[model samples]
Target: MVELRETRIQTRQRVQPDDTNNYGSAHGGMVMLWMDEAAAMSAIRFTGEWCVTAHVDGIDFRAPVPSGDTLYLDAYVYDAGRTSCKVRLRAYHEDPKTGSRTETTDSTFVFVAVDDNREPMPVTTLECSSEESEQLRAEAFAAFEE
Candidate 1:
């Protein structure tokens, strides 16, 4: 029963002379880095114990965000186990002037709580009380299947 909420992360990096590939877009690794950070934040909020990324189940680059575009990441924890939490992350490109948004990438990641020795630590049950929570739970399941 992880407590999940919409979390945001922003990073601005220009499509520098050296940052672009043949396509002149931000590298895939750069996008993934932001996604991981966003997911980690959600996981930490859900589990008080230190969390380590157990696995990144799936990362789909739905669109390419140009290097000059600002990347916005939204993440939330939707499910939890005794020691693991599932976080859903979405990356979008925002037009600074018009404030238009286009989703670029989305992924689901799992993190496990660990002690100082890096052993798995127990986590409390998640509490889902509202209709939104129920919808999130359903989405988490559908994402897991994908």
Candidate 2:
């Protein structure tokens, strides 16, 4: 079994001019790309196998990340099935100077563990040993239900 916290992944990317849209904010596509990469890392950590994205749940952009801000991405495996892992991903915009952060986007993604031959493989069960991990799992499920 893999503990939920063991699969948690966090990454930061500086928003560059080329990564922004005409509105001078981070492009939705660019943000989604980062989210996918972070989620894949989390799934691989949990499953100990190469995983491919199976589906992305609805992604909602709550705020814009300006070009000068740093994008903070967090991903973790909140649930798992025989072959698939569901990851909860969130992005936040942080001001480099004051270190203030605001949530920019959130979504969920599903990934399937695959073998060397690219065939789907069973994944070990996910466990939540800490109270924080258990709360995170419950929150993830609640968000999915909404």
Best by lDDT: 2
Please give each candidate's TM-score: 0.83, 0.97
Evaluated at residue 99, the lDDT of candidate 1 is: 67
Q: Could you tally the backbone clashes for each prediction? A: 1, 0
Model 2 lDDT at residue 144: 92
lDDT of 2 by residue, 1-146 (tens): 99999999999989999999999989999999999999999999999999999999998899999998899998999999999999999999989888789998778999999998999999999999999899989989998956
Q: Candidate 2 at residue 142, lDDT?
A: 94
Query: Which stretches of model 1 miss by more than 4 angstroms?
Result: 6-22
lDDT of 2 at 129: 96
User: What's model 1's overall lDDT?
Assistant: 0.74
The digit string of per-residue lDDT tens for model 1 on 1-146 reads 44444322344444444555568777888778767877887777778778899999767788877767677777777777788978877788777667688988767889999999999999767777777767876787786765
Tell me the lDDT of model 1 at 144.
77
